[model samples]
Target chain A: MNPTPDGFSTRHRGGKKSAARKVRRSSAVNRPSTVKRGKVVSVADGNAAIISKSFQLRSMQRAWNRFHAGSLSHWTTTIIIALSLTIFGAFTLLLSNANTALDNWTGDNLVTVFLEERTSIEQIESIQTEISKKSGVDQISVVSPAQAMARMKNMLGSEAGLLDSLDDNPLPFSIEFRLTDKKYKKTANLVYEIGTWQGVEAVSYDQIWAEKLAAVIHTFRFVGIALTVLLLTAVALIISNTIKLTIIARRDEVEVMRFMGATDSFIKTPFVYEGVLQGLFGAIGALLLTSLLYWGGQGAAAELGAAFGIFFELHYLQVGQLLIIMALGIFLGLIGALISLSRFLEI
Target chain B: MSSESLPLLIAKGLKKAFSVGKNSSLEVLKGIDLSIDKGEMVALLGDSGSGKSTLIQILGTLDRPSSGVVTLNGINLFALNPKEQAVVRNQKIGFIYQFHRLLPEFSARENVMMPLLIGRCSPKLAKERAGEILEKVGLAGRLDHRPGQLSGGEQQRVAIARSIVTEPVLLLADEPTGNLDSRTAGSVFELLQKLNQDLGLSCLMVTHNNELAQNLDRQLHMIDGCLAEEERGK
Candidate 1:
């Protein structure tokens, strides 16, 4: 559409390699007595024209034109591919940041006490007052069932919509007490001491959470690595398969180019550009979607914190990290093109 | 070092064999020596299985000979690497197959500009050159027509234009007009002769048309991988 590109023109002959430009003058055709042709361009020069750098730029322009000239079906497949990659990238982003969120949750080193199911506000107040008297004690806060539900909703973000079907608040009122690090031994003794209180039905401590969080983080690191490999493989295959179809469609053109002495670079450059562009654009799309989701999450977290005193944040990925994601997109595209092209073109 | 006195292409002791099985081989081209001088158009007459294509493939550097050396413009063609040979093919040699092999996706001008683009000419320069050659082939009015839209004669003419657009030193054509009707073939062949004369283009043609062979400067027959001069001469 943009002036038949070099892709269609990468197979012609050289009349005078330009090296032969000044080397000839004696041919009978040069004398113009017998030759009847009009405006003849003699290539009597021994060498063909040298390949120019501008042709490469023109070649890329051609490739870009072809890349965008696909039908609706082609674009749909590409966008669907971008969406799948976005889902995977978003999941990975969340997984990578999980440790940070866990650290924030465990940072205070607090203990929670679940009161009896029907405990009244007076009974919870008495227990909270009694716990405040213990050594190594930080301030204790009483959490009602409605406040607890609100905290859970904040943590769940968009998934909080699932809570509307519930019959009623399934949680009970609880007391959360923060312990100071300087009296770490006293903190454990206080937690045991509180377990024996009259109104307390069950007690929870951050020590267990601290231990569990560390273990889960370590295990998840391995899982995240495995998922990364699988995600990359999927990206490569999707791009490879799509590009392969294009290559198959143009096999004859490719063969003609090869026979006409077109180099591997000459024939393969456009397809490779297609793959890279697809990957890069796809990656950009995924990153944008991921960012939008994280923004929504950050807002939800802020709302929950203001309403129930819980802390969380979905901090945006740093610039260096974002660049790495972009690099990953570019790399996926190149590898995909290489895989498909190598199989189909045998180059 | 002077190309003026050196032949356009020379092949000496060229032998090619294929492995038909585990230990044995089938010799397609027997040891042979051949040469084409500057601006000479020589026709090689042979039947289908007479090894003419195999010989030309080697001479064109598309395929290497089992044991032989080919020198084009006094530089040993086979001695160069595949990449170098490809450059030579694009710059110095042009080929026309029986089928015209033009890329159907492109217009006549675009198809004609392929070799120049492959050789890395600027797009503007390539376009001008392609227009000139297409005009020479009498396709000035059909530069934008795709191959499918053109008649067989016009398509073959486009193919010839592409082959000669680079002004190659040697043109190796295999049954160039084989796919066309007699009338179309005659006109295309005549166009080829006119090009050979007007541009001082050297040519090596393999054809089964004996009647057409009498018009070239010289004729030779390839019989079972051997070459013998035919009494037919212009």
Candidate 2:
């Protein structure tokens, strides 16, 4: 008999034939009384159970371990994510500034009606009363010819001296009013109707420029959305591929874990966390990059505004918008991990 | 009917076949019937192509038999779903491969702590148990050493410690000492024998060493997808 490490002789058992017969006989009547029905025993009791806090904590630890082990690849993927999100953020900034500028320019929704040079002051008053009665018209102002000429001189700045050559005020008296309804079509109809009225020489409104600007903003929004979708998809694919490489590198580890009775979630949760971390860090980096762009572009934006004779200010993303970008980054990372895990990690 | 009388594992008519190409099939295990009682150590001796590893895998729930019923602790292993089978594998079975298969990135203690962690054991408890088991396997001083930093014998000892750390009812080792030299292989075999006796851990080890096989309770010799002989150990 073989001596065991404890210096005792190993127990001598029956022959193979007797043991086989016993096993066969036992198999015939084998029914375990301890078997529980419809209830899974906890892992602590030497049975399979769902993931516990300890398991989740270990998974998180492992994710960090993996991130550290493969920092180069992880950082590369993170940089790509950061760059993609930065582009998205820049587009958002541009759209926001354009929208703010449009709002400032169209805030009053003012329309101007120029009267004939021969029109009497009483006629101008009657016309103002008529326009005030029109639907959606508010805040009527009557502009005398001298008042119009004075406004022109103010606008002309240093060139106001050229207007002194005129013997009389050549500007026509005009009526200006704010439209409560800012729809282009409605304002156009109102302007056309007023232009045909007696003593009215021409009718004009800034609604046309507002409408054009709105159309441009709409197109920019569409293109921005399309580009963002494409770029985000690319980011997801990059993350997925990076995770796939990690899976491949750790294939043996996965198999060993599987054989050790690791649940699918137990095996998958760490990878998911890895993806989430990558996305989170990438998003933070993108925010920094976006902030730098905003700060650096502030002076240039001011110069452009001066050139256009208007004030343009670049605003940083609001809290809600920043939170959304962060959330999107996290979501994309999660999706990327799921995609890779689903295709590559069978367990 | 009694727990002591029932074998720890029982397989009846286990068969495994693989498709070769189109019309031909390769049969690896043809109706293999086997059993290992609690605290019994059985040595499976076979040639390279005799399906010993395949049988071990099927018994361990790592691979499914084409047609068979594997009962462990009186539960039909194959009858359970994949998830349930995984739990059974985790809580009831421990596996040792020839190459040790210790994760290169982890320390010996950490590697041994893995199965316990996978079973949802707390890290502190796992660490303590890992330390205790590593001390048992004569690797207390090498607890924090990685597999690469250790010798082959030390690595195998770590693997042994990892396998028994969970206190699994059944240990399935596939040529666990196949890659070691004779001296190291003998020591490793002795460790397995000792663990089997001391812990009453049922073991089904596949190996080519007839001398080591003779030390077990029984020796099962497989030839060409069949058990050709069964001999009682010395």
Candidate 3:
């Protein structure tokens, strides 16, 4: 149940062969992994308990050796695979950042309510009271028409003369409030609640623009996933072909293996390990390339953002992302090798 | 498991046929029945295309008989699943070809250690045992030499060392010294005979050499897919 132990049970009785045999029989796994499952006979009762643990280590050791068996073509194919995967990793980071940007836009969390013209002080006070009493409203501030005009004049500075041409103060008395985190749960309901107030003329927030950004981000994500699947299939085919070469080069070895009574799993395991090795290395290279691209992309992205209102900064892969990348590389290689070897091992 | 009193190898009505084309088959072996006792060394002699090689392949379980049963030590070999049959082959049988088919990249000792490694023996023990067998074949000094580096006779010697390393119940060799010179072939055959006697290993070898066939415990000649128990004068 622990998954970490080498899958051995330590309970023991007398020197009964059946008792020792019981420990080996418990594994539901019918097939052996890298380590050949050990035969627990011949050893004493105490020593037999640790046999699975020993074989577990041996399988890993053998796998490591087999992974490094072939070179020239293996290296070339792996490098190409790594480059393709790097492009995949980079796009994954971009898509992640797009979602992050949309979240941040929503997280600004401010609501503004515009008041009717000629609204009295008592009416403004009542509106403020109602806004504060709302479930998600954290703090409220009411800006009078006169105060708003004065603030605009100070902001305009030299352009204050342009506002003097107006016959009367045009700015509306508005109420501004900071919403709590709970505001996002039912943003539309809260907006509707404030708009129904007697003195309120209109209620406005950044929700429309944020929703638009979210839609765009979702579309990009869908496209990115489709592209990634296609690229991964290509990687698998390349690896399968490369492993085919390795298998062909070692036909003599395989022939000898068959003649000597080696099981299909026994012969195919080393090749799978070899594929995994290539995949592991390919993933490491991909990870490094992604890191470098992110580092280099920071300036280019900033400059491109300046031309359009749109802006995003490339985010480097997170720890979880890195783990995923590694897992993907290994899985691809494993699958690629398996796919390749299966054609040759039709028996 | 059946009773252990049965012969080590039993091939009854063994027939092998290859499909030459659509609806046309070339029958290589026709209803051949044979048995070899425990610890017996037997040689099969025949001219080219006499079906000697095909008979051994079927007996070795490398090729399935078109219609027949090969029982090894009372267990029906062909009846068992391929995986189970392979396990029996690994632990119970050894094979040597005319050409020493050692992995070119591996050294002599490593070549011998391969089957033990495949059987999941620890590397240390497999290596130690491989070294011991190489010594037995008088190649103790050639431990590190690759098959390509070893001479014709030495490579054959390494092949012999590998075949006996697992202490198999049966060894199937096909023209083990066909490519070697007469003197080298004689020496290799002598090494094989010595190992078979010293280790109590049973053998079923296929060769065209009458001189070599005369030295075995018995000779069976294959004439056009039919086996004749040939008599010999010492």
TM-scores for all predictions: 0.73, 0.86, 0.76
User: What are the per-residue Cα lDDT tens digits for candidate 1 across B28-101?
Assistant: 88887888888888899988898999988888887889998888877787766666666667767889989989
What TM-score does model 3 achieve against the real structure?
0.76
Put down candidate 2 lDDT per residue, B21-101, tens digits, no spaces: 999999999999898999999999999999999999899888889998999888888887777777777767999999999
B38, model 1: CA deviation in Å?
A: 2.0
For every candidate, give the share of true A-B contacts it also has. Answer: 0.22, 0.31, 0.28
Model 1 backbone overlap count: 15
lDDT of 3 by residue, A54-141 (tens): 4444445455655555568888878977987897898888877767766666776678899999788899999899778877777689
Give the higher-lDDT candidate: 1 or 2. 2
Measured over the true interface residues after superposition, the C-alpha RMSD of each candidate is: 11.4, 12.9, 10.6
Superposed by TM-score, candidate 1 places the C-alpha of residue B186 at a distance from the truth, in angstroms, of: 0.3
Count clashing residue pairs in model 2: 0
Supply candidate 1's per-residue lDDT for B88: 67
Q: Which window of 10 residues has the lowest lDDT sum in candidate 2 chain A?
A: A2-11
* Docking band of candidate 2: acceptable
The residue ranges of model 3 lying beyond 4 angstroms of the native Cα positions read A1-56, A109-204, A298-316, B1-6, B17-27, B47-51, B79-87, B119-129, B223-234
- How much is A77 displaced in model 1, in angstroms? 6.0
Every model's DockQ, to 2 decimals?
A: 0.33, 0.25, 0.36
